[model samples]
Target: MSSDAELLEASREDAGAFRELYERYALRVQGYHRRRTRSDDAAHDLTAETFAQAWLGRARFRDEAGGSAGPWLFGIARHVLLASVRRGQLERIACERLGLFDRLDCRPAAVEPQTAWLEDLDEDLDRALADLPAGQRDAIRLRVVDDLAYEQVAAALDTTPQAARVRVHRGLGALRTKLNHSTEASR
Candidate 1:
C-alpha cells in the first residue's frame, strides 16, 4: 500500500500522484469542514481550497512525525478554517476565484439536522469551545473534536502526550461547567 507520506513525495515529482493523496483523505477533510460550517456549500469550497493549497505546498511538506500525511493535511485545513474565521469571511465563495471548481464532484447533500433541540445544543457547545483558551481549545479539538489519540494530538500540537492530556482534561472540565450552568439557566 502507498503510505500517505510516500504518495505525497511522489506527488512532488509527478503531479498526478497528488490525486491519490486527495482521494485518500477527501472525505475526511470534507466531513470536518461540513460539520463545522453552517452550510454545505461553504464546506465544499473550503475542502477544495485545502487540497489545492496542499498540492501547491507539496514541495515543502514532510512527514515530520514519521506517520501518514493525514495530520499535516488536517493542520492545513485548521489553518484555512481559522483564517476564514479571523477574516470574518467564513461564507465567502472562493472556488470560482481559484479556478479549480471543476475538481470536486461534491454537492450539498439532502439532509436535515436531527432536531432544533440538538441544534441549540450544538450552538451552546460552539460557544463553550470558543470561550476556551487557545491551548486548551486546540487540545480539546485534536483530541475530542477530531477523535485523535493522545499521541497524535501531541504530535499535531507539538507537545508531549502528557501535556496534551492535561489540556484536554482541563478544557473538558471547563466546558462541562459552562454547559451545566447554561442548562440550569435555561431550565
Candidate 2:
C-alpha cells in the first residue's frame, strides 16, 4: 500500500487519487465530527467543510509521526470544527452587542407561510415526506435535508450505508410520484 503522502502527491495531479484519499478517511472524520457536535446536521455541515478544506490544503499535508494522513486530516477537521464554533459564538456576540438577538429567529427549519410562491410546494413536499414510511422518511431527511454522508446516515439509522441509500432513493421516488400527481391535479 502506498503511503498517504504518496497518495497526496498523486492526488495533486490525478482526481481519482484524490477521490481515493477522500474515501479512505471521510467516514472516520465525519464520525469524529458527529461525536462532538450536537446534531447530525451540524456534523454533516462540518464534515463537508472539513473535506473541502482538506482538498484545498492537500498540498500542505505533511507526513508527520509515522506517515499516516489520518492525523493530518483530523487536524484539519479540528480546525473546521473550531471555526464553525467560533462563527456561531461571534454571531451570537454580535447579535448581543447589536441587540439583534430578540429580533432574530434562533430556531432551525422554519418555513414561513409569507413566501409569495413555493410555500405551497414546501408544504406539499413536507406532506409527501410525511407520507413515507418512517425508515424511508428518516433516511431522506438525514441524507437530503440534513446532507449527512451516507455512512453517517447509516449510523443514525442503525443500518448499512447501502440500506440507507436504498431507503433515500425509494423515498425520493415516492415523493416524485406524489408531487407529479399533485402538479397534474393543480394544473
Angstrom error of the Cα, residue 69, model 1: value is: 0.6
Task: Residues 37-130, candidate 1: write the lDDT tens digits.
Answer: 7567766877998998898888777544343676567667776766655433222235445554466532212322222212342576689889
TM-score of 1: 0.49
Clash totals in order: 0, 0
In lDDT terms, which candidate is top?
Answer: 2
Instruction: Give the least accurate 10-residue stretch of model 2, judged by summed lDDT.
Output: 110-119
lDDT of 2 by residue, 96-172 (tens): 77776566453222221111221232565678788999999999889766979899999999999999888977776
Q: Cα RMSD to native, each candidate? A: 12.0, 14.8
Name the best candidate (by TM-score). 2
